[model samples]
Target chain A: MSRLFRSVSLGLFLCLGLLLISWWNLFAWSVVPVSGADVLHAFTSFNDQTIAHRIVLDLRLPRLLTALLVGACLASAGAIMQGLTRNPLAAPSVLGVNAGAALGMALVSTLPFLYGALSTSIAAMLGGGVAWLLVMLLGSTWRVGANEHGRLVLAGVAISALCAALTKAVVIMEEDQAAGVMTWLAGSLADARWQTWQAFWPVALISLIGALLIAPSLNVLQLGEDNARNLGINLLRSKLLGSLLVLMLVGAAISAVGSIGFVGLIVPHIARLMFGQDFRLCLPVAMIIGALLVTLADTLSRAVTYPMETPAGAILALIGAPFFIYLVRKRTL
Target chain B: MSLSAHQLSVGYHGHTIVKKMDLTLPDGRFIALLGPNGCGKSTLLKCFARILPAMSGEAHWQGQNLHHYPSKQLAKELALLPQTQPIPEGIKVKDLVAYGRSPYTGFWGKLSTQDHQIVEQMMKQTGTYELRDQLVSELSGGQRQRVWLAMVLAQDTPYLLLDEPTTYMDINHQVELMHQLQALNKQGKTIITVLHDINQAARYCDHLVVMKAGELKYQGSPEDVLTSTMLKEVFSLNAQIHRDPVSGTPMCVVED
Candidate 1:
């Protein structure tokens, strides 16, 4: 038991170290480079006249905060979804959540009346809710016994493909909005700002707390539905509340960061590999791992290309796809 | 009465499996539900355990409707062991058994010292104490079955419902488990199980309920219910029934 606590504390400390490094990296290695001393001076004593101060306060801080929050939110949501479906491959992107949220945001952007971050997030939540309901309806039709994981994956892929096609069709019809939509869909953190963090943090906090609260029920759920029901878990209520929380997390994330992928898909897997499968331990660790993963990826994306920004999603998939294939070969999923 | 189903109709998706059947299960008795495949034995057991909702009528616990009882309160009264449980990946036996304390534990599911002692006691009772640290996936089928039984026992309910609990065990282990359940019955726990083997059911269970095609064919002692003609009618097999020499219970030998 002490060993387990030691390992968890070690993992937490490692995450904190990485988060500090990410903060340093965010300040030090942007389009306009600032030295370590410059970063310190800018943070400790602010002057509007200094270029370092301007960059750190206006650009780096918000972008750093956005990446951390969005990453944590999406990854935690992915963990919950995996538990809900009892399928490890279940992620927001695979479940058509990202696509649905993107579609909602896209539509809201085009509409004259709905033009703010809150409206966009609300629309995204509604879209994600619809996708979740459809998946539940479709998933329930099948018996979902031994091959439930594979069948649900197939259903998710089909729904994702349909949503992707519809989103593309909508974007193509509007020529003026196409560039912004295309960039957002590619998932860059270049435009992250204070407003984005302000719009997102409450939802992220709610989601994190909600996931922690439901972690015990999820443990019972992993024993299967009948056993869980017999063990006094209200299956329908747990599942419904869990899915709603996932939607809030994913919706807030997509709206803030514009559909960053694979953090949701891969971070939970890595967390499980490091920690055990107990959700009480895994949920917090998953959030930490998620924050670390995206922060590193976003920092590397900006640094590798210098002035030209690269989408973090592209970098993540370049790494994530191979890992996914390895998992498939191992038959773990 | 431990559990009584009144005008109960159970099914899925508007199709009924067990329809409008009324029955009362007596407390502190070892009961066996025997039926052929697709005869609704499992479905009926699930209904009594409250895992499935009755399509028409009420299932009662101590004269109150089972549905009316709060789920946690009901769980404290009845423990169910379903067949074909999925093992969560990389879970240890001790951790798995700790889940049984969820009803008594608060929202965080933290195991108190008393809860841990109960879990340990259950593990020892089911002979899974040695395997507590091992991962579930690393254990063999029989060992895994015992571990699951320990989990159910850790729930420490007064009434237990098990559907084919002996599926993966060897003959020796099966008899051992039956004796353990008998010990539990002697301690005043009501045990209702669905069993495949007629001889084992007859030897171990005091009361027998036989079903055919979702309807109750017989409900009595094994001697009264396990007749050769009733065996042929219910199981569609030719069998000879005789009293066991050791226990004086009805034992059947199927004639091919």
Candidate 2:
């Protein structure tokens, strides 16, 4: 009972922290300078003519909302991947999703005719789906069991390498079109608008709910494959649904912000430390923490350069790279 | 109301372990599958539990194909405690035990009041109630074993299969586990286990099934299966058989 109380309190604290940061993000280091009240007036009373209210309504609000959803999606996807693979290091970046999406974005942004044919987000989704499919097939999880977790990770690494190389080649070849790809590749929320949020939220929300619904099966999976099967989990079905959910989440986030890395990797371990291993509890807490971290990073990004915008994803990678090293050395894990 | 394997050839990959074997396991009895190393006793138990698919034959339960039952329905009827489990990180004993009721729980795995009662009862029966709030990873080997058993018991299956349930325990813990399993079997569960200890199996288990190199060597009551010649033929050991002073069942005394 005390643990439950503690979890609830911690959850409440994280939520409160997210709100506090969101407020800070609205007014802090704004190029057009808006106050908290101006931010509020944009929501309560709309004035298209006033620049402050217009900046708040048209730019900052959508960015804030997008950051929240993006953070939530990535962290949940990380937690799900970790659970499904039974590898502590499993994340969208490590498992080829991010690289594959980057490759898709690179191809679309650089190849003149192909770039115009499809939205980068849809292309990203398709590419991630294909990469994950290849990883799953190479892992041969169906004929054998999921005991080949190590093999799956190896396959992901190889695919990520290939995709990264292809993306680099695309960027180098099309120097003129590379400017847009470069900023997007850094994973900035600077260009976020209401239209982006409108396209991103519905899919992100459905995938979030899907992640929550599968939490129980993922819990059983933690017991290992043989035991999971004994516990009534259809291993292939659970894994298929889990991977699909991950692609949906990661595809949406990468498309929205241009391949934000490390939030997916770092947030899940923090959530597990705070809330224990039950995904039902852990994923929600991870979502809040992810949101909190991204909002904080976004807030700090403006202040970091003071009037010049910095990509929130770059700031996250700054923290995430060192954390990854720490996780690699944390043998007890 | 029966569990049997019909020409069940179970194995991993293409290598057949238990090849085209037929066996009818009697219901409502304490049974043990005993064999030398590589004999496939463990493989056979896994087949009956439906954890492994039979390569070329069928496992039948209650007059129907065991493979045909939906996994949830199968889970409600049978439970397996594998020889080795990687202790789940950060799972509380009570929560792990509650997972045993997954077949009966909602999609979110919320236990009903009756499920709570069953989980409570299982913890008590396995003598792990005191460790309810404690982490499974932090428990001692004996306590961890009992906690896992509590989870399996919470599954509330009449058919239980355990693969080498006492691999890492000290003699005292091994004996204690045997006693606990006997008590559970007394409640009318069809308890089937793969055991390494010949003397332990003979002393506690009412029925014995012996296998050697994937073939059924001998099976009957302890009196019928524990003869010195059977041990020599099946186990490749020249061992003498004598009555156990306590249970009066045949016990093996390996020749020096």
Candidate 3:
């Protein structure tokens, strides 16, 4: 209980610190750099016609929220995926959910009428659902019982490759839509509008709540299917519900900020390493750590090449890959 | 009856391993299921545990169909210890055993006072109370088996089904485990175990259910079931069956 309190307090502090940093970054480095005082004034005076206030309120705050939501959603999704599949490498991107969402967005851009943010979001969700279904089907079919973890990884890799190729094909054919999607595909928070946050928070909240609700089952599932079954866990229900929750999370994240990679892949592992392997602790800690990591990455993306934004995905991958390699070598997973 | 199966056929996809079989296990008896490899003893046990769907018929505990009972309800009544389960890493023995209270606990999986008491009781009963704080991954095979059995016992079910519960244990630990199970059985819990060792089954089990090629060959007291003729027919081996002076139970010695 003290450990739980300590971890929770630690997560809360980190999140609070990250929140301040995110808020400060929103105003400090933008098209027009605004002072912290002005940023504060902007929050106090919402109706202020000052350009700095408008920039802080209308532009950066929403983007910051979007990044935080994406980070939390993707990270939680990855953690849940890792738990369900019992595979350390499992994540939204690795399992092809993000790529499927990207493909969905690409396909939606092809349609002459369904080009709105909502339509694209729905399309991405459907695509993610399809990909999740495919991965599950493949995972189950190729499952050799003992080597199921390996099979799941293989299926994820195969589906991710397939979806990436198809998304590329779509991008290559549509030159007009390419520019709009290019930054998104690389995973940027630049286009995060208020509407994006409006659409995103609900999905993120629902998935987080869903993750908490099913965390007990996930913990049991880590014991393997037979033990979980004897312990009264409905394996099919947990798997299906978990998959659906992950799909929603990955779909919402991709729809909001394109496909931010590695946050989903590494945040869960980091959380587990810091806090124990129990999903009850890991899930919530992963959320806070995920939010911090992406917000930090976004800050780095803004600052690293001042006046020119670097994609957050690239930044996350730079950090995540080395950590992943370290974890693999250490076999901590 | 504690548990029974009627016209039960269990198998893998598109293949029936255990044909239409009927079994009624008497209440509070320590029973052992003995059969040759691939003779469907495991499959039958799995079917009873509701891990596998019955290919044709139904299984029941008390008066309710096993399938009809909610998973938690069934879990409260029956606990199955499979032959092998992948041990999760970084889990303390106490935490792993606490999972047995999942049927009774709420969504958060917090152990109430009673739940904690039961968990402690089970750990003590299985001789794993001292190892409660140790990581499951760090335990030896016998220690691990006992811990797993502790988890099963923590399930607090009236009926326990174990598939080769003593597989990884040495003779000493195996006998200790058998004695622990005997204590549990004496406390009114019905235990149905599938064993590879005929002698061990005969010594420990009050009743024997022998199978050959997915069919029940004999079901009775060990003295009636462990006869030389039955052994020859079921195991396809000529064996001398003699009572041991110690326990006076039937012992099989294979003839060259």
CAPRI quality level assigned to candidate 1 from its DockQ score: high
Per residue, candidate 2 scores C-alpha lDDT tens digits across A305-332 of 8889899988999999999888868744
How well is each residue in A1-333 modelled by candidate 3, as lDDT tens digits?
998698878877877887787876687557686888787888886656788889888988898888888888999999998888888888888777888888899888865555664577788888888887798788783242554655666787799899889988887787888887777889988778998899789878888899888888999999888898899998788888998899888888888888888888898888888888889888988988888888888888887787888888889889988876775676543
Candidate 3 or 2, higher DockQ:
3
Candidate 1: regions farther than 4 A off:
A111-118, A141-147
After aligning candidate 3 to the native by TM-score, how far in Å is the CA of A323 from where it should be?
A: 2.9
Alpha-carbon RMSD of each model: 2.0, 2.1, 2.0
Please write out the lDDT profile of model 1 over residues B1-256, one tens digit for every residue. Answer: 4698898888877889887888888788999999998888889998888777888988889899987788898888899999888877879999989898888899999999999999999999999999999998899899999988998898989999999999888989999999999999999999999999989999999999998888888998888999998888998889998889999988998898
Name the 10 consecutive residues with the lowest summed lDDT in model 1 chain B: B1-10
Best-first order by lDDT: 2, 3, 1
Give every collision pair in model 3: none
**Winner of 1 and 3 under DockQ:** 3
Candidate 1, A1-333: lDDT as tens digits: 986797768786967777586767557556676766777777788888999778888888898888888878988998999888888888898777888888888877764555564488888888777876676666662242433666666677777777778778878877788889888887878889999889889988988899999999998888888888889998779988998999999998888878877777888888888788989988888888888887888887877677787888777777777876776677744
Give the top-scoring candidate (DockQ). 3
